[model samples]
Target: MSVSEQFVGGDGVISTPIATGVGTGEKAEVIGHRTADAKPSGEYASILADTPLQADEAGVASRGMYSPLTSLCNEPRFATMRRGHKVMVGQNGWLERPGSIAKKPEQPKKAGFFDSLKRIAKEVADATEMKSSRRVKGGERGRASSRVRISLDPREQSLLYCELEFLLTSALDCYINSQFNAGRLDADKYKKVVDAWHQKGRPKVVGFRYDLETQLDLVFLHMKDFRFYGDRASVPAAISGILEAMRVNARALRVRTFCQPDSVMAKQLLDSQSLLNLLGSAEQRQIQLAEVVQFFKIVLEREHKLQRTEEVRGLPQ
Candidate 1:
């Protein structure tokens, strides 16, 4: 018989039976398993194709093998879901919160030399502007104050001079009387009393012009002695009065200097006014009073001849 006719007879099989260990004639089907259907078309086809459940076409895949790979593509059931956000492997594991990653801290920016210079310059400019504005306001206030007239009439000036002279003589007399009553100045209190007396005397002598330089020198020495020993806390109101008197003297001297252009008295009064202002400023209060007064006296006693002029004559001139 021909080979095709022999193989094709009745049932479709080889003429001779093929050898088999598990089955003879036909292969056995496994329970609960079947050949997977050929992949579906359209969207279903694409999904199955993309899923890892589908093996490469070159390999044979079993129907029972779908559980592991297909699990990856499934939406997890709420009942079996885990409680944290999914993270990629090898990403930072530290968390700022239970569900979020910690962010990296940014570095502080460093300033350059030029940047520091710019900041300093801006600060200096702001301070200078502020100071200038303050100075302008002060000048305006000074001008406004100046408009209130201070009469320098001869009668008024003479009365002021006489009152100051009386105050000085009265203070000296009071101190002498206290000394007499205390039965000779106590040894420990002697220096204090003497200093008080000198302190009392300085303001009185400051406004006057001396006929001889010796008199001015003696008064300057007395001022130094008083400042050295005078108690600041117990500083009498008379000291404050003296300071005010010095201020008045400065203002009056300025006015007189302007009105009488050819007067030595005005020049002398100006020098005395400058010294008083130096000693009376708020800053001078903190310094060693003796040293401050000494410096003031030295400046005042500098050798300079007074011009001979009859205009703006002082008391007893």
Candidate 2:
């Protein structure tokens, strides 16, 4: 019998069978199985399929990172289901979040000079053992958070695409290992952790000799769709980062127009508004930035008040 026609018989046995007379005289009901394709299709379907009673899939994702830890009965019945099924779709990395190009709120900048130094000192003072609560000052000027600023290198700001693909894989593993069994990680927490750990972040894509505009567009794309923003100040930093990365990539990739624009001379460029507008237009990430910045300002103000209250209750360092 031909291969196609050979698989025909009442017992579902087309190929050679272990038990020759048992079902071999019949037909091959199934094609493949755990050990071999000796089982019948009707029987195997029930075995492989996932039912309400059975929660795990007996297969691994491409990267072999994910698989369901489902139990048929879970000791007696659903034993907590803590370690759920894992399906590694990809690898590990960042997935750009959606953003807008909206209007930013009007707020004073962080500082004219010594920005990081001042902030770091304050944080250090607060967390340090050198300062005692008895001598700490209480109630001071209320400060508005206004915005969030993050800085990175000027080249290849975004994670590799393949690496990003793995984020799903990592995310799955993370979910599997996490205490939460809700099957999805908290997005806010994920961004905070990832952004905090993001190194080599910048605008330019080293060794990639693509169009300057296209490359720049991608930098904007990350802002518009990948990176998360918190406030007005964030936009500037994001813009700065992307622009700088592009410039850096330009040098390495031999692509023109990849370096930071002339606007980087100061905090706000000589033509600050215009530069902002240009980047905003290209990135199409303005709308969201504006909204978030306004929201963060309120949060910052609250923080400032809390700090003041604590100071008023004590002395100065």
lDDT of each: 0.28, 0.28
Per-residue C-alpha lDDT of model 2 across residues 162-219, encoded as one tens digit per residue? 2222322222232222211121222233333333333435332111122343334333
| Model 1 spans > 4 angstroms off | 1-148, 183-317
Q: Model 1, range 1-317, lDDT digits (tens) per residue?
A: 00000011122211121213323433212111112322211110000111122111111222212222123223342122348875544365343355555577898898763354334334433433332232223445545443222223343334333333232222233322222222231212333333454565632221111112222232233332233113331354544444454445434543533322112222233333333332322222112222222222222222111111321354211
Q: List TM-score per model, in order.
A: 0.19, 0.20
**Model 1 Cα displacement at 40 (Å)?**
99
Worst 10 residues of 2 by lDDT: 46-55
The TM-score obtained by model 2 is 0.20
Candidate 1 TM-score, true structure as reference: 0.19
Output the worst ten-in-a-row residue range by lDDT, candidate 1: 41-50
